[model samples]
Each structure stands twice: as structure tokens, then as C-alpha cells.
Target: MQQLLDHVAALKGEFDREVFTDSYWAIRDEYDLGAADEQFWPPVFQRAGIESDPTLVASAAAKDAELASTIAREPHQLLLEIADAGVPLGILSNAPHRMAQSVRESDWASVFAHLVFSSEHGLMKPDRAIYDLAASHFSDVEPSTIHFFDDRERNIVGAHAAGWHGHLWRSVDQARFELRSLGILTKR
Candidate 1:
């Protein structure tokens, strides 16, 4: 990611990692709340003592999308089996608009019944609003009947607070076991 940051810095002039990092952290929440590339990048560039060139902004957006696309590996085989078994699957992600776009364009997008991104909703995981919104996607399913798995403890805690079953994800085997214990997945 530093390499990408370096490339972004080179687009205008000398790069200061400290300035860039500070600038990015300052508006990280805004970016995750679905700010457009044009909206978010200019401030970072300006903060880094560089001109907010349109070309530079576009390049940064492209790099962000590219990086987000490669962040997740192929979907787990268990997820595929779950989907194949007629169970609904949904994605609730705290990601920027560019990341959302990349995921929507990926082949795995079809596997999910719903995809919710913080950028689109102005809320992020570990927040009750986001959990409530995600629960709504299930329509007829009651919150207690819903199950969620996340590697982040806070996110799982949020899920539980929202009245859904939450699992602290560790590995595929762990997730599979949890699902089976809940009777959500039974195949051996």
C-alpha cells in the first residue's frame, strides 16, 4: 500500500509519508461514507502540499479500486456450498465507494443476495445503524434467526447487539462448525 501511496505522491512532486498518512486518516471516515473520488482526493493532495490535479485524482481512484479488488481472495468453498444450498448470503462491508464498485464488478458479486457498503449508506460496521440496515436486507427473516461471521470482534459484538447470532471468524473450519451447530449448514 505504501508503494501505491508513493506512486500517488510522485504524480505531483515529492511525497511526504507523514503528511499523506495524516491527511488520509483525517478524512478516512468521510471516504468510507461514500465520498466520491473527486470529493475526497483533493483534500489529501492539498494537505500533502500538492496541487489537486484532476489527473492525479483519477489515478489515485484507479489505484484504490485496483487494490480493493485484490484485497479479498476467492470466496471460501463453504460459502459457495451454503449459497448452493439455497441459503441467502449478504455482504456488509465498511469500505470506500471505489472498493464497493470493485466488489460489485467482481464475479463473486452474483453469489450474494445483497451487498451493503458503508460508502452507500453512510454507516459502518460496529455501528448499530449499519447492523439494523443489514438486518433489513433479510426482509422476512427475524434478526434472531440471522447469523453473521466477522473477523473483527467489534463487528461481531455489533451483530449480537442487533439481536443476530454472531460468530468471531477464525477459519473456514470454525465457521463451518458454527454454522452446523446452529443448524444453518448440516452437510458433512
Candidate 2:
């Protein structure tokens, strides 16, 4: 995200890092950036004073997009490890609907019971409604028992406030350590 923002910032003089960050989240909070996949971006770019198609602008930054899409092997292995131990898994991402498409294309689709994204519901994280919606996918599970891992402190705080066991993501080793503590990764 930072890389993509920097790419656009280089093209548009007015929207520096701070301006881009503010506008991006403000728009995501207002309309959910994934509401129309990449289409939700044109309005945002317009706010930043760039009228060219956001997709075209994004296409010009192919390298950043490519880097963004790469998934590490360790996370995949961790998912398989826990899944094989019968721990149900889910994903709550404040990303575009294209992320769901990527998950579908990869092995992650089967590992997770569901992928709840912001664009689909017109709500992003820090919004309790999105957390409630994610919880709904697991009918019998209590929200307090569902652990959410995110890199952002605000998102972790939001998920925790929403009654989930949200934790800041650091490393795969840390995750395995925590999951083991929860007894969710015990060997079968």
C-alpha cells in the first residue's frame, strides 16, 4: 500500500504521503475501497487531483502490484499445520474484492472457511458491523474465541473492541507460539 501510494504521489504533486494516506482511509471508511474492486480508486485519485483512470495509474505501477500479491510460504505452511489439527480458520481483510479472487486462485480458499472483506459489505475494519458480519459466518463460535491477526494497531484495537481476540501480527513463529498457547494447534 505504501509503495502504491508513493507511486501515485510521484505523479501527482499535491497528494503527498500524508494527504494520500488521509484520503485513502477516509474514502475507505466512507465507501469501502473494495466496493467496486479497483474502481473505488478513481474517485480517490480524483480527490488527489489526478483524473486519469485509477486502473491505468495502477497499471503503470505493475512492479508494486506484483510485489503486493506475493504470499510467503511460511504462512501457507502455518495455515496447513493448524487446519490439519482441526482448528477452523477465517480471514477478515480490509482489502478489495480482488483479494478474494486471489485467495480463490490460491490454496488459501480451502484453508479458510470464509474470507470476509470490506468491499463486499460496504464497510471496513474498525467498523463493528464488519466484525459482526464475519462472526455470522461462524454461527456457533463466540466472537471472544475468534482470534484476528492484523499488522495495524488500530485494527487490532478495533477487533478487540468488537469482542474478538485480535492480536498484532509479527511473525509466523509468533503466531504458532500464540496458537499453541491457545491449544488450537495441538497435534492430533
Instruction: Judge candidate 2 against the unseen true structure and give its global Cα lDDT, from 0 to 1.
Output: 0.72
lDDT of 1 by residue, 69-173 (tens): 663443357778789778899989888988898989987677889999999999998899998998898998898888888888999999999998888889888
lDDT of 1: 0.83
lDDT of 2 by residue, 16-69 (tens): 556556666676643444555355566656666666665554563343335444
Clash pairs (backbone) in predicted model 1:
none
Among all candidates shown, the one with the greatest TM-score: 1
TM-score of each: 0.79, 0.74
lDDT of each: 0.83, 0.72
Using alpha carbons, what is the TM-score of model 2? 0.74
